[model samples]
Target: MRMFLKLNSLRKPSVHVKAPGVLALRWRLQRCCFCSSPQNESSNISVLRHLTSKIKATGPISVAEYMKEVLANPVSGYYVRNDMLGADGDFITSPEISQIFGELLGIWCVSEWMAAGKPKHFQLVEFGPGRGSLVTDILRVFSQLGALLQSTNLSVHLVEVSPRLSQVQAQNLTGEDSQSARDENEPAYRRGTTATGLPVSWYRRIEDVPVGFSLYLAHEFFDALPIHKFQRTERGWREVMVDIDPDMADRLRFVLIPAPTLASSTLIQADEQRTHVEVCPEGGVIIQKLTNRIAEYGGAALIADYGHDGTKTDTFRGFRGHKLHDPLEAPGTADLTADVDFSYLRRMAGTGVACLGPITQRHFLHNMGISIRLQDSPLCISPGSAAELPQRLYSAAPAPGLRYAHQPEEDGRALQIPRPAEPPAPLLSSGRHKVGEEAPSTTSGGWIQRTGTLAGEELRSTLREGVIGQA
Candidate 1:
């Protein structure tokens, strides 16, 4: 995970990481664990010095080249060995919030698996299964449904770039049910453990994840991939870059360069004003490949991220702990993310795999029964006991509870709490679906809209078959 670091020609200073624990510990000692000051100030200085030295040695270089070096630098790069999760980390993710979030997603997976004909062996893979709470909640639910868990023969796969995070996940999942048992005698969920009584495999990249009948889940995964940001200029959309100077440390600045060809058609309307457009070519490529895999093989995928309805503005920013920060603060230390492009995703998925959403995390989860699960939890009404409840359940918990995912609207700002939406119809016609002008309902007769076209009589016959199978 090499990051491209850069410095602006007009920047006051450059930011760099002197040592891993120094900046992180400074915040801890101050009890401002969420502060971005140390890394931002330090990174700016380090980057400025590195750039100045580089320019002296090799002459002037493009901002893009410099950023590439800073982030991906072999020895002192940020992403090489970073653990930016939890209260002391750069940012928190959905699975870190609560078990219900992952539990509901697990339920969603069950339905998807059944829709996919209940393959004897299928991989339930997650991208950055943060803190493993989501997976744990999911497995907890799986444990309850003995038939579903046993029948599917679920093999869990995780693609995590951070080895530190991988260990955290393994601790929560592969150990004995210590957390689930009595508090007084609770044991730590051991690392290198497998509570499933089943093996779990961890990999660094999606390409390494074995292909098969699989269910793909990526919550807040797309945004972290490096994005190419372009602002509409008089000439055309120019790419955004960061320039750093090693000598003038503690400063980082954003700059733009001409990129006539790479500028997207979507930026044409914003040409009158200097509107910024962001694109993650890497994330798009990954989506294309994953969609192709799902289409070719029998499977489903759900991607939840903070992104826009279309490719429009530059939605890139940085974060430390729970608060937002100037994106230019730290080269590699601070968490950098941008909005995902659902339009691009849908186009990539094509007809092979049905891409139901780029829907808001709220709406998607609501439709899939997150709210119901939340309401049923014992802690919902009795929430005042622990402030940790908000951080753990609503904010970033490693247990099975409520979780958060980002929702970026058109203006480029993100919604704090994702509101749930109605779930998309099942991708394949489950025997449960009745395709007809009249809305089909669950046997309990709950209204659900059907899109496109399917034979009405055939749909009803299929529904009846499901009813019979249940009986």
Candidate 2:
């Protein structure tokens, strides 16, 4: 592994290692470590100065408000600055890991479409489509469906806010050289089509997509939404806020607002002993919109991301140059994210829709025939790449879970959480269990380990073959 230094304005400069063969595993491990130095003065002072001025004028801001300003504030937000994907960028996603992941998802979509009576016209939409890798693979697989590609009126819509990324998506989808010509007054839906022969459009919001039968894909999308952090205190839960450090003058710090609000009221009953909890209204709002769209217009969504089903814990962090950095260090230079509370998404999904399998991606892919695909089609991936795939897929102990939930207003419409024959053993060697052995019940401090390994596998299997009715 060859390491190099990447310096930014704030915090101690980080040493990013270029792990050639095992980049995925190395990057993920480093990200989870949360090992980075304190905040330092940044080179990009525009956003920082703007934030400071705002805070000084209006007082401290919520984590969600800070995240939105730093990440989506048109002029200097992180995503607005440039593309942050692939090996040289901040982080690599699963679609970028291997084409196989997308292919499996494409196949899964086809199965669902068939079950949905193969609607004559339907939309294939993706949210936060980074570099268009996943959708590209999906279109390729759809092309293999012969008449299905030609007969069915399948239009592609990408729900992306970044202008730079939208241009990248257009290029990937259309093959023709494309650039975003977004007008200041016009809505951000760029009209185009893929080389695979599907008409495509780009939108800044999900609501912009035309309402109809649709298949929505949101991989690693919800995690990026802004989250509100709350800490349990003697006076009840206090909302976390971002403020300038009085001592450092240039650094940003986390401060709690002592006042209790309506938002913190519900969380107080969840747990009194827990230290911290995150609530992402942005993510919840998106889920509600998606579920409402599916229920009203007729469609289904597949969400794959790294998060616990319902566990309440602080997962807020930052990533830059594929390494973990202090989230509060740099304002808009690094990607700020928190784990998706799938349970919250389920609860907020409202009535008339079913939520299925917050199952592990490992089991979902395994049931989708990932292992067999590698063995049967050896030429699909090189040996070097193949060796790294499993480690990347299972590197984070239990990989990100996959959820396949949809509305049941139409015939044969259902959500599945397949039950795997056996649970997968933990991949990380953390003094708990060896490979292929059952995980230990409790840790040294009497902390019970609620491993999602087997539960994920079983959920995947159940979704594949079984049907769970609407609650």
Which residue segments of model 2 deviate by more than 4 Å? Answer: 1-43, 177-188, 266-273, 382-388, 396-471
**Global lDDT of each model?**
0.45, 0.56
| lDDT, candidate 2, at 277 | 73
**Among all candidates shown, the one with the greatest lDDT:** 2
Off by over 4 Å in 1: 1-79, 176-193, 244-250, 258-274, 379-471
How well is each residue in 1-471 modelled by candidate 2, as lDDT tens digits?
A: 000110001111112311111000000001121112222245247778888899899987788888898889988888877566754455565554466667766766665455345567768888889888888877776776554546777888888889888878788779783435467544545777666557788788887788876777776666778888776666667776787888777777766676776667754446345566788887777877776666555656766555554564666766655454467665777777776666666667755564444434554555565665565454555224555565554433322222222211212112222221222433332211111221111011100011122123432443344221101
**lDDT (Cα, tens digit) per residue for candidate 1, span 1-471:** 101100001111111311111000000000011222235556545655676577568643443354445444544444444555554555444443344456656655565454334567767788867677677767765666565457656678878655556677777777542222233232211214366576577766678777776777766566567666555555655555554334344554443443444334443343344365556666667876776565455565656554444643544555554345445554566655555655555555445433332223333344444444544453632323323333222211111111124322223222232222222221211110111001110100010112001112332332233211110
Model 2 TM: 0.74
lDDT of model 1, residue 406: 38
Q: Least lDDT summed over 10 consecutive residues: which range in candidate 1?
A: 22-31
Give residue 258's error in model 2 in angstroms.
1.7
